[model samples]
Target: MTSPPLSDLTVVKRAGRIAAVQASVALALVLLVVGGVVFAVYLRAQNRQIGAELRTLAMTADDANDPPPDMELALRENNGHISTSDGGEPGVPLLTGATGFSDIHANGREYRTLVVDRPEGRVVAMTDLAPYHAGRNRLLMALGFAELAGILASIAVVVLLSRRSVRPLANALALQRRFVADASHELRAPLTVLHTRAQMLAHRVGTADVRTLQKDADALVADTRALGDIVDDLLASATMAARKQARDRVDLSAVAMSVRDSMASYAHSIGVTVNLECESADGTAGFDVIGSAAALRRALTALVDNALGHVHHGGTVELRVRRDGAKVTATVADDGVGIDPDAMATLFTRFSHGAEHTTREGREPYGIGLALVREIADAHGGDIAVASKPGEGATFTLTLPAAPPA
Candidate 1:
């Protein structure tokens, strides 16, 4: 079955997250700036109105002996004593400015005062700002609530809109998953039948007198087995793709040793030696990582199997697990004919022609095993690296983050 396009889902989700964050930050900045500007304008206008009223009162006190009603006014003679105005002390300190306004605190109250200089003396007209200040404070409180509500509303809208916009992508991902599952299910039965038939024919041919037919049957069996392996790899890939994040404390040393031991018989049959190497910092046999045990075992098995299949009859494949600070690494090295630099470039890619370089007699490299290993590593939030020389050997290393200490 062909691989469906599920990668687009990841791209869409990542891009959506970035865009939503940027939009939210931009919206917050815009609201804050606009609210600040409006508040500043209101404050300036309030100041202008109070100043104009105070100025009128000051001018009225300059023309007459009486002050405007409900307004506090003071007049000083040339010697700076209150002459005539609102009843006050005989010597009142009046501000010197003629047409300017200043704020003052008097009698536990805030006031805006305008000073005017007349031909006789100076006149001071004052108005309390406490009421205006209270109103402004209330307005600011309302605006603060409004700004907060707006930010929350914008976040809600962004979340809802982002989800709505990605509906099509989500649908596409669902369809792809279904397609892959169905296709793998459908192919499973036919591949099983073919393998059974090939095995039956090979068995029947073993008793035939025609030697040529026997040889042809052996080849047929090998090819059919290889095809079955390919199908199995495809099904495994599909299964892995469908799995969700399931992180647990996985013992890398155990997984590596288990994979090495499991592949021992196969390596012996192919005239290759498989070895396991593991060590802890304090000389223990445990190296912990955050991942699924089954998945890690499968990935290590694939690497070991790949290495064994490529090495020659007397070649050695070593599986090593080691812990380095906050990371654990599992490495598979084979002293077989090494990989070409050209082929090594695309070695881990799925179905790449470069991965099918060499194989043992009964084992064929389908170019899918390494790809599956890489996928498994990535799913566990790990990474794989390869190093090889044309004639020396190749090494595959899988690195995973160490689990936090218990």
Candidate 2:
């Protein structure tokens, strides 16, 4: 619709006072230039005609016979007026002074005395510039109107397109909000029922189905706990994503060690070992920090679980805590099927492959654990990084801000 053809058609209705002014200016310039050229050509032609007339008089004077009666020296003159006739002529001979010339312009016309012979008389010619100027004014008026019309159409199109893009975004966001609300409601009851049944089986003793019930109870507890962890992680992610950098006075060093101690019994059952280390500089004790404790522990546990699953018999899992000035660092490393450098790039991305994918043989890594760790780091205004070489070992680091002044 904004094409040149369309804009020109739209001009008659759209163009206004400004277009009219532009057309007037263009017309003025065209008239001035044409007038100058026409005037110059007229002067040149008149000069040539005057010279030819003079040559004809000179030839008449040189002829053997006497000059014509009209050419007699007894010419009548008084204050440059010639009222008398020549010799026996019926009327006075027309001199260059008696004839006048005219010039034409678009709106008006001009006249002037023309005397070609300065020594005797002067002659002049007319410059007809009116027709060309009229044509120029009409052409400029049309183009000025077209330019004004194009600008208005472009503005209308931009407003329409903005409305088109905004509507779909508003609808998609509303749908996602509705979907999450409905799904969370559906998940609550089944999980609570499963948790209660497992506890009941743990208490029942000498009941008719006690033997079978005991094994069922243990499996139910493990799976239910795993499911609970996944749900909690998801909730935490949503919360932290919404509320960035929730900081308080949290003892990071104690949190790391406590988490390791809590998992001791579980590691022992799986033939795994744990070692915890702490190093605090002056003005530091347990490496307290202004950070998110729940998020930090969640991140630590995910890395620990990954480490414990990979380490072999007698192979150790180390949790180290330390601080340097404003920085607090914690590391979890294990001697296992070391991660490949290529996979390290996506190691913390959601659903990425890891050492757990291959080391456990039967059970593949579900993949969100490390992803959560990185998310927590980002939320706390920190970061998580990993370094590994195949056949050697792997180390993961979590770096956070030290506690701030109250």
Candidate 3:
């Protein structure tokens, strides 16, 4: 069974795989951060350990009987001697050479300090917080490395998982492109034959028996032209998708009115009415801003033509044109039996005309709106969108961004 174009799971799946790249990037960044924090903790712990060793050595030096002037604190503290014993004097200094110590308590751990006195009455002290510092650092290093491992593992898993999405999407896109190329190719041969046959039979229009043949030939030519146009539209859309077209300044309002005029005539011939409301403004010399009179007219005409298809007699087809910023917008609306909400999701996909009256299945498809509208809009650096409900009317809006400011 053929699926609708817009929401093809294949495209979404490809898109989804591409999206996984971000997940990979995120995982790598997380690992980097975790690793950095872990390394930082290691350095901090090493610094604390060095401080502790220095203090211990200072205590050892104080034990020496005769020490250098700077080493006097280490000698005095090493001997554990003081002029007065503990509690002998309230204000008596315990060590001869040392400064005060700084201590802190954290996370169920106590950090202690020690002071030593030098012969010069200077004191030196070192905190015994090395154990607490070392333990926390070891914890961070372990956890941080674990985090990095998990991130790498996650990336491996994602790459494997995302392939499921990639293969199917690539297959589907290849299938659709091949189908379009084949169908368009096949139709061209028959259409060329029909066109040639019509021209050859043109002289027989007055003959009684040949008159019918001539009429049929003419009809064949007309139908073939339409078929050729459809093929052209499909090819154009593919071309635009493959290679970007340049953009230029386009006057949207004038274009809208012109297309409206054309559609109005077509409507009259088909016993319907079209209403046009267009407002023009002078704006920019922007980039990729293709709003020339002819192109905008074509875009508007495609929309009007699309609206006319599903529209009922006495129903109105309306068009409105407005300029915004550096870009322009044209909206075409119709009062008719609208589209199914579920179907709108794929409403603008290629080869998406209905299965009745137009295709080999004899269904009345609203033909080629997606292909032509997309081509026209895309060529002008713009886009088209549809809004519809089952019983309510449908609206197709075209939006083109203005050129970049010079």
Candidate 4:
């Protein structure tokens, strides 16, 4: 059996955590290897220095009564007599006849001993290993603390770096999911319009005149072409990078009119009326804005579609466009069951619903269309706003930069 598919958020989070752990482990291993090398070198040097000191004392000492600091000397005569230095401790292990370097442990302490044979007698030189052992212990303790600190630091650094490195991937995944959802929502309205037109064409085929048949066929073709355009636009958006696409002058009034026309059949089918009103600061017919025409149309279509979904039968949905200063504003207003004040905060959030309404034809709002509209408006260097009350109507206004005059 196949495993259930993971969400984009889950995949991104898991990937980031895995990357952090792998990086932390890698850094920890490096620290361990370095520390091990340093520790090994320290032990080797300490042992070598101790051996040299023992050899020196054994070969050059003349009297057992005087020995180097922290060292003990023992002399054995041919007659088997034994003696120790004045300051020597009692527990130094002395090899009677052995004549080489060796280690001796006695009285819970360690000693490095060197026995040398001389002309008159035998000499034994010894040094306590306690201080050297203490030094080694100190070094080990320091290394242990350093390793702990290094591991902790590595974990922190790796987590921070991994989050920074994976942030772009996370954003891309989020955008991909949003794109798919937006595409699906964008296609729904046109598909519905096409389906409605097809049904009408089929019903009129039996008794309709040739001219009427031609009109229905034309309408179906136009809807299909519009659907194709939406698909192409979505595909282009997916493949292209942001802020790099070519933009041209788009008339907000024209977009509003087109949205009203496209949604007319669907709205009529649901017993709702769609209207368009345009005004300009200079009393011009068109309000020009610089952006992608297809995107602007999609944005307006989403607004109208959302309005149609919420409004009851016989309700009026209006598309109003006007120019103010350097901005062109288009508003979609509907006399439907207005949105609740509490739901306004999340109205543009994907997959969020608004106030309860008795939808026409069982077409409940899926809550993706308005979110896409907001994104489109943002992409065009514009913003959207809404005003609504519980019992009154709702108005969504999209404002975009006006195109400079030719």
Give each prediction's root-mean-square deviation over alpha carbons.
Answer: 12.5, 15.5, 12.2, 7.5
Error of 1 at 208 (Å): 1.1
Q: Write the per-residue lDDT of candidate 2 for residues 28-112, one digit (tens) a residue.
A: 5565565556555655675565445434543333221243332221122334643321221211233433443222232243212
Clashing pairs in 4: none
Candidate 4, 1-406: lDDT as tens digits: 9999998788888989998999899999999999999999999999899889988888788768868777898887778777888645442345354678787776676788888888777888888888998998999999999999999999999999888888988888887877687767767887888899999999999899999999999878867865775565455445434555348988888888888898899789889999898888878635989888888897888788778877888899989999988999999999988898889989988657774665444333556667777778878899999998765678999999999986
lDDT value for model 3: 0.61
Look at candidate 4 and tell me the lDDT of residue 285: 38
Q: What lDDT, from 0 to 1, does candidate 2 have?
A: 0.60
Off by over 4 Å in 3: 1-177, 181-214, 280-297, 324-327, 355-367, 375-381, 403-406
Provide the TM-score for each candidate, comma-separated: 0.51, 0.51, 0.47, 0.58
Summarize candidate 1's per-residue lDDT along 1-406 as a digit string, tens digits: 9976647778788777777777877888888898899899999999888888887776665533555554577777687565544533221455444456677766676767777787777877777677789979988998899889988888778877887888778787877776576555545655665677676666767575777666667666666666666777777776887778577888899888888888898788778899888866667535898878988988898888878766877889989899887788999999977787898778887655344334565443556778889899899888999998866778999998888887
- Residue 214 of model 3, lDDT score: 60
Q: Write the per-residue lDDT of candidate 3 for residues 1-406, one digit (tens) a residue.
A: 9966764655677577676778888887877787778777777776676466647645554333443321222223234544322212211232442355544343443433345454543233323345656776777778777876887787878788787757767776777777666566656666676767676566666664766786677567556656665666556555555564445555566566667776676687666688977554654332235445554565677678767776777788888776666666778888876776766666776656532121122112424556667777766667888888766778988888865554
Candidate 1 residues lying further than 4 Å off, grouped into runs, are 1-225, 353-356, 362-364
Better of 1 and 4 by TM-score: 4
Number of the top lDDT candidate: 4
Q: Against the correct fold, how does model 3 do in TM-score?
A: 0.47
**Whole-model Cα lDDT per candidate?**
0.76, 0.60, 0.61, 0.81
Instruction: Give the Å shift of residue 80 in candidate 1.
Output: 71
Query: Where is model 2 poorest over a 10-residue stretch in terms of lDDT?
Result: 83-92
Q: In candidate 1, where is summed lDDT lowest over 10 consecutive residues?
A: 83-92
